[model samples]
Target chain A: MLEGILTGLSTATMPVNLFMVFIGCFVGTFIGMLPGLGPISAIALMIPITYGLDPASGIILMAGVYYGAIFGGSTSSILINAPGCSGTVVTAFDGYPLAQKGQAGKALALAAYASFTGGTISAVFLLVAAPALASVSLSFQSADYFALMVLGLSAVAAFSGKGNILKALMMTVLGLMISTIGTDRSSGVDRFTFGRMDLVDGISFLLLAMATFALAEALMSVLKPEDNGEADEDAMRNLGSMKLNKEEIKEVAPVIARSSVLGFFVGVLPGAGATIAAFLAYGFERNLAKAKEKLKFGLGSLKGLAAPEAANNAASSGSFVPLLTLGIPGSGTTAIMLGALISYGIQPGPRLFLDNPEVFWSVIISMYVGNIVLLILNLPLIPYISRLLAVPRQVLVPMILLFSITGVYLVSFNSADILIMVIITVLAIVLRLLDFPLAPLLLGFILGGMLEDNLRRALLISDGGYSFIWERPITLTIFCITLFVLVAPLASGMWKKYRKKTVGYGASMQE
Target chain B: MTISRDQIAGLVFLVFSLAYGFYATDIALLPGEEFEPINARTMPYVLSGLGAALSFFFVLASWRSAGTLKPLKLGLMAWPPVIALLVVMVIYGLILNWLGFVVSTALFLIAGFRIMGERRPKILFGVSIPFVAISWFCLTQLLDIYLAPGRLFSLLGG
Candidate 1:
């Protein structure tokens, strides 16, 4: 472990990697400050640029962007009451109120402090946790892997909130269906090309990511046109003192610690990610608060703003655990990173650290470095970054549109890809309107090939019998977990319904 | 008689799955490969069934809540710009081969800016052309990447 840390320190401290981290954070902050472009889209936009670099630098750049974007989102949420990403939505609840109260600088400062602590703490926890998990998972077999992918896919839907469970699952199925479009690698059999040569490769992950996320999101935002930057400009003029006196620090200290720990654990869950982590931490803090403090939560309580800022950052750090150890991305943002890592020809799984120590440890170390850079660099630069983001949507949106399309075209040099991207963008916009979660679709598409390969291997090993599912204890345990994850939600929902009926019947009897 | 948005989604997916399943049968398999435990046909068959089943359940669930669920409504969302932008993107795609990277991208950005109500020729021409030129330079000179010259240029050169 010490040796690995040293390896990471050496790689991450290199001038180029450090520069990548800086550039990533700056760009990430800029993009994340833009309403409607979340970390996923930010990361997606970087995919093309990162294609020119080495794997470690590429990933380092992305990790920095991920953290920077989250921090930037909080900036928007505080200053303008418009959250740049879902993870920072909770930040705005208290943050915007604080900004309105002439404590915009304080809110920004506190959010930055919370994020730095959260990121640093979780990076430490990850330093200990990731290697242990990777070593254990090194023994994962085909059956176990198949079960794990299913669990990951199911968890995405199960955790995608209440009404969209079925829709998310449908998207997952659609993703899988799309994944089967190209020829089958194992048997050399063409499946769904429909005689089109472009169809043979199915779809490019970069293109899908760019289209569905960057292009679709940019276009989707265009559907509801933005104001002429008046609100942002107004908010920028009065930024109050950034200093947090001893009293303010003391008040939020425990909240930050509690939320950071809670956020890390939630982020370690397969699909919970940072948004849920921030929400959970906010709720938990509110519930723990005294009556007076509780009332102050949405009215700009220091603790309230600090709690989510800390938690979301911690959760963001915790998310990388699965990506490194299990090769399953915890959320849509990480899913795109997973796709990028795969394109770099580096399979990030149990073998990640063992095979690519520089890549692995460098990423982990760069995350911590990225956090420091954000605090020392971006916090002070927020006002300027926000102003830059005020570039009118008329100009900004088209530039983003240009980048989104050209990003794909440059990679393949195929004009047809541009056309295909248009189709996918339209489909993505329609699906977004219909309220289908597209993350699962991307995750499913990414995992589809691996899932099929594992299942096929498991079947072949068992002589075509399904017994391997139950035969291997590891596989059985994973499948059981998947079953629980899938069934528990429905069972609990039904139980609630039954309880409601019984309660209603008793009320009727009394009447 | 009002099919909710969820129902429409479900119905579309259901039809897609059925069509996908139909096509799954047409996938060519090596002789004796079909007997294998898992082949090209295996995943498609499973995916189609899963897709069909999920969509069927989704449609049924939506239908069960027919009165409660809202019908599909996209009227409030601004349509002209979205439609224009999408068309602009499609045209951008078409013109790339004919006009090359610099001209087509510049045109696309200018047009996109115009559609979004940026009428100032200064902002439009000034931003689009220079940006495209810089990018073209970066790709061609810095990255040493080849952006194919326009087809018209190629014809002239030949």
Candidate 2:
């Protein structure tokens, strides 16, 4: 094990790997600072460049971008109310309010520290959990994998919330349908190529991801004119000058630790990405606070800022475990990585460990190095990034839209992809206007292919026997967990409504 | 504030998807005798069925919640961009093979910018020229990805 660790470290320390790490972090931070761009878009844009590099270096660069982007996301949330990405939405709860109060400096400092803490702690967890999970996955048959995919899909449904259950289900189904657009994997027959030669290999996950998330977001931003008042004179203050008091540090440290653990677990769950983890962490933190104390949450509670910041970063790290071990992606970013790995002739499974220990362990070591580098880079640079808030929305929006168009077009050099992007963008705009959540749609799109592939594979193995779903202990356990997740929320909501009715009746009788 | 629009759209999408799945299943040839009967199309069919059922449920739910479902009000700027995107996409689809990436993309970007109300000729030329140049160089020269430089550009040694 020690020899393996040393080998990994030596490989990651090479100048090429180091340079890619910096480049990824630098590009990631800038992209994350852009209000509408996310890691998905950043990765999509960068994938074209990676075609020229070695697989390890390419992977390292992408990883750097991923971690850097997450950290950079907090800059916008802190300086302005706008979160650059969904994962940073929780940061905006406290971050923007602090900026408004002329303590943007303090909030920015605390956010950086909290991010570092969360990322480092989660990196440690990943180091421990990933190898352990990979070992356990060595024992998994096709049956176990099939069950895991079902669990992943069901978990997405549960996390999607009951209010838009149908839409979420529809999105999931649509995703599965879209995944079937290329040639049949098991058979040589064309499924839905529609005589288009470009689609014979299937709709690239990279393109679909860009369309669903990046282009859709850019369109949404364009349709709704953003309030530029956030960039008013007060936004220009330097955040580096501020320091967190010892008391503030003490208050947030526990929150960071608790959220780090919570975030790691949330990330480990398929379909529950950083946004949900952060939101869940904030809700938990709020409940722990007093009623009056809760007032500080969205208005710059240190814990509020720390919890989600920690959780989201941890979730980001945790997302890789399933992808690396089980060959299943827990989030869209990881899904794209999975696609990239496959494109590079590297199949991510149990054999990934036995066949390529250097690839697996080196990637892990690089993540740790990336986290440390991000901390060092972001701490001093907070003030500089905070200045990004001053860029006018008029200018910024146009630039972002241009980048989106260019980026999407660059991916496949296909005009058809641009059209698909535009259509999805319009759909997203319409959906947003109607108050439907976009995250679930994205979640569905990411998981749809996995769910379809696994369900059929499982059935093929079982020979249409329903008993296989229950007979496998792991499958049964996952199914039960999914059932619990689905039913628990509805039960709690109904109980609350029932309690309210009873209380109202008692009040009427008293009157 | 017709709730039916949502339901109808959902139903149409669901039905089309189901048809597509059935068609896919019909075309799919199974693997070797070593494998079971279930093939690639089975899961798609299952998902399509689930989608159709969910769409029906959505319609029912919309009807049940009619009293509570709020009317959707779109912004003023919404329709123009949507229509422009649709029209441009159709046109681009047709002209892409004929005109190639350079001519098509320039026209698309310029028109898109105009639609967004950037009327300054200097701004238009400024953004358009650099965008075309950089995109061409990066995609063609740096990355080595083959882009359709159009018949006109091909004649000029593109």
Candidate 3:
């Protein structure tokens, strides 16, 4: 393992690899600075560009984009209360408030530092944990994988929050249904093609993702008015001198450490991703902090800002574990990476370690280097990047819309894809207006095919018995944990309500 | 906007999916292998069932939550971009087969810039033409992805 780590570092030190790292970070920061453009879109846009490159170089560049985008996302969120990506939404909770308080520079600096610490530590964890996980994954049968996918889907629903449980389930079901739109893989007979040649193959996940995220977001941005004079000029002036005091650092350091560990673990779980990790980390930090004194969490609390910033960056690194080890993507960004890998004929699985150790380890090594590079870039470049918020929304939204359409069209070279983009974008707009969570919809689309494939294969192997999920200890353990995550919240919420009612009744009787 | 809209859409999708699922089951030819009884239709049928259940859930939920609907504000200025996109897509679709890659993209970008309120025609043409040329070279000349070459471009041995 030690030798492998050294080997990985040596490969990453090559000039070509180093140059790719810089290019990826530069492109990633630019993409990440753009509102509503996340690592997924950036990577998706670049997949065709990487198609001609070597596999290791391609993977390293993409990994650099992924981690660098996480760092860049914090800048927009802190500056303008606009989360450049879903993972950075929690950062905006406290980050924008800090910006409002004229401490944008300090918040940004701390964010970069915390991101660096979280990312480096998590990369080390990934190096240690991925090989062990890969070894264990070697034992996993089709049944175990099937159970695991179900657990992943259920966990997405559970973590999607309580208000949207039914909608999330519906979206997951819809995604699974969409996954079956092509010809039957085993039977070689058309299933839901409706006699169209294009339908012979299923709808592309990339197309669906672009439609849902990029197209939908662009449309939504157009519908929203441009911010003309929201931010205070006085606050902007004060930002020139903003810096974190020593006392603030002493308070935030432990929270960052704890959240980093917590976020990494949450990210290791399939379908949870960085957003949930950040939220959970923030919740943990808030609950653990001094309760007697009212801590201004959600309003420029340094701990609140640091916890999620650290957690999400760690989560970004943690998410790569399943993708590299088991060929499962833990988030939307990783799913796009998986798609890009497949397009390059590089199948990511347990055999990846033996077959392409350089590809695996070099990409991992680039992640560490990418994080350090981003820290340097973000700390000094915050003011410049923050200036992006001053651009008129009218000008920006149209350009984004134009690029989105062009990008989607360029990828498939199919007119039908453009039409699909419009349809999905409209659907997304309606869904968003209805208050449905878009992340669950995306999570569903991603895991739907894998879940269907694995479930069918498992049943075939088990000879149609449903008992396979319970027979395997690993599968059963995952199922139990999934059940716990789902049921725990409902049970606790009911219990709390019950206690409150009883206490009220007792008080009335005493009165 | 109404519970009926949600219910109707859900029911329509449910029926469509059910029909498709049944048709798919009939079309699918199961293997004669002794080891496994499950076939391709099993997963589709399962998904169909889930879809049907969710459609019903949507109907129920929309009914129960009907009163909770809030008024949504729409920005009027947003319509122009949507219309512009629609227009660009139509134009692209129409020209892609005839005008091909370079000409179509340049025209599209130029028109797109104008529609988005860029008034400097010189800048528009200058920026767009080179972009189209580069995209043409990269996609067709280098990567070997077949793009439709314009009739005019073909005269130049494209």
lDDT of 1 at B120: 95
Q: How high is the DockQ of candidate 3? A: 0.47
- Candidate 2 per-residue lDDT over residues A265-317, each given as its tens digit: 99988878788899999999999988887988887788898899989988888
Worst 10 residues of 1 chain A by lDDT: A224-233
lDDT of 3 by residue, A1-511 (tens): 7777777898998898888888888777767867777777677656656766888888888988887777778877887676778899899999889888878878888888788888988998999999999888989988787777777676676666435566666666667777777876666777777788866877876677767776666666666644524564344345655467899889889988998899899899987889889999988888987874236897788888999999999999999999899887777788778777876777787878878888888878888888877877656765665566555444455455556666666667777776767777777777766556665566666666667667777876777888888888998998888788667766886799899999999999999
Candidate 2 structure, TM-score to reference? 0.89
Model 2: pairs clashing at backbone N, Cα or C within 3 Å: A105-A239
What's the CA error at residue A302 for candidate 1, in Å? 1.5
Task: Compare candidates 1 and 2 on lDDT and give the better one.
Answer: 1
Model 1 clashing residue pairs (backbone): none
How do the candidates rank by DockQ, highest first? 1, 2, 3
Report chain A TM-scores, every model.
0.98, 0.90, 0.91
**Which candidate number would show the highest TM-score if scored against the true structure?**
1
Once fitted onto the true fold, the runs of candidate 3 whose alpha carbons sit more than 4 angstroms away are A226-247, A291-293, A388-411, A489-511, B1-26, B30-36, B75-77, B137-146, B151-158
The per-residue C-alpha lDDT of model 3 at residue B144 equals 79
What lDDT does candidate 1 reach at residue A454?
A: 90
